[model samples]
Target: MNPLPQNMENALTGSQSSHASLRDVHSINPTQLMARIESYEGREKKGISDVRRTFCLFVTFDLLFVTLLWIIELNVNGGIENTLEKEVVQYDYYSSYFDIFLLAVFRFKVLILAYAVCRLRHWWAIALTTAVTSAFLLAKVILSKLFSQGAFGYVLPIISFILAWIETWFLDFKVLPQEAEEENRLLIVQDASERAALIPGGLSDGQFYSPPESEAV
Candidate 1:
């Protein structure tokens, strides 16, 4: 019998071990496992990119809607009158509304950065942004009488707060868990490979049987 190449036997053994190792995959040896992880990671990140696009779209819409509400509030609070009288309308009182849109832009940017640059498995960036947004909105509601004027006051801040919280929750619950699980799988496969490398021949004495070199030809 011709001697089996060490590498070929290893691949066969890897496929066999997949059942007890990675339930969703075969090719558990280091080289193949690394290749599989690289491929899977690309697809995974592509999926995440799509999700990021969706989230960014929502955040953009929130900012625009908040801006519209602010514009409406301005007109309602004497922007039209100031224009007719040729006097500048004092917008400083409602400047917090502008901050809301700015913070929303910041929130979405940080989200992309955390994943693309930091590769973070936690929601620290989003959590911080959400905290600031929530607190600011709360203070705006409490200290200001904008609600007394119309629902625009409460609607603007409330919707912004809700959207911010939603993004934070998504990063913490959905994104982080999935990424961490995949990473853990990859690490386990790598550890198994390193351990296997340290062992002697990955075969029994009976498996070492082989024909002469000339006969194998």
Candidate 2:
């Protein structure tokens, strides 16, 4: 049987060494295995640039916008005191963007935890927030007497609905997807390079090679 060419032997050796190191890593634990699988090669680039800023701003705006709408609607509904007397003190929860504002605040804090603390770059966080917000807002729009108020009442729900959808679109289509793709792409690296060689020579693909004097057995 013919011996492997020098380049082929070197490539095989390099591959085996890498695999051996990986095997040692896997023997340790599952966490170590995951860490070594990507070798943290692209961890620093897992998410998009300014992901923290963009996502925080989005949640901030959501909370603020809902609060603004609640304030205006509150005044139109005879101020917070009257509304609380009727909506809360009377053992009934009313819809005037107040509940949405509270929900937005809660959602903001949770999203901050997911993105800033846990460093999740996936769309799940934003998708979940959007879904819940939409459901609540939709239910309120249906049950509430906002249409009897004026243009402001009509516009409030409409704007809130639009904003919630916009948030989903921004994350699912643009920010989160790009970050997720980057992370996934990095994790999808090949086990070994097909063109790797220990000794560099002007060798083209599919060409036969002779063993050099230094590498010959």
Candidate 3:
């Protein structure tokens, strides 16, 4: 008989152990254990790429909506009013609504910045947060002077700050990588444990067969 490869031997042992475990599992609490395992596997299947893609789609749709609003604000007005009477009517209706649209645009940008901040890696969050917060603060100061409108200038920053806190506190936006790392570590540990269970031991003969150890440099 041909000698089995070390990996093949290990796999055979593991399969036997797993079959035995399944029998024991079925004898005990089969339903609850199977359900828990299925749930964990499903969550792991969702993965990081799926999450990133979903976030990207949301950001793209929001940007497109903001662009549509801008088009409506600029094109639908026909023309600026020449007469004082026409100007008053236009300002009251079109101008006021257009200002609100601009405010919406500001809000959209802030929301994007907040999203970028949240998605930053563990080490990158500090720099990303600092940059975004500073830019929002500076934009508020400059736009407040240039536009001379308090609502248009400050609304974005105020909303951004609130959203930043929510991301940090509720969503764990900053800590996702850390959580993922810990999850991967747990998986490694579990895999190692399962592999260890497959090792052969307690032979009757004086001679022993064991898995080879890797040589250290």
Which candidate leads in TM-score? 1
- Expressed as tens digits, the lDDT of each residue in 67-177 for candidate 2 is 787777667678878865664556433434456667778777877788777877677887787788788777877788766667766776677677777777776677676
Least lDDT summed over 10 consecutive residues: which range in candidate 1? 208-217
lDDT of 1 by residue, 1-217 (tens): 4556665666666665653453323233557756766776776667564444555566567667766766676577668555323322333444435556566667767766776556566667777888888887788777776666666667777878888887777667766666677767877766766665565444443433334233222
Model 2: ten consecutive residues of lowest lDDT: 190-199
Number of the top candidate by lDDT?
Answer: 2
- What is the lDDT ranking, best to worst? 2, 1, 3
Give each model's clash number.
0, 0, 0
Clashes of 2: 0
Q: Can you give the TM-score per candidate against the true fold?
A: 0.58, 0.56, 0.36
What is the descending TM-score order? 1, 2, 3
Clashing pairs in 3: none
Deviating ranges (above 4 Å) for candidate 3:
1-38, 48-130, 169-217
Residue 18 error, candidate 1, Å: 18
lDDT of 3 by residue, 1-217 (tens): 4445655767767766776664443343334444555655665566433444454445445445544544443443454343333424565432243433344445446544544534433434433543565565555545444234334334434544444344344224534554576567557545544544454432232232344543333
TM-score of 3: 0.36
The alpha-carbon lDDT assigned to residue 71 of candidate 2 equals 74
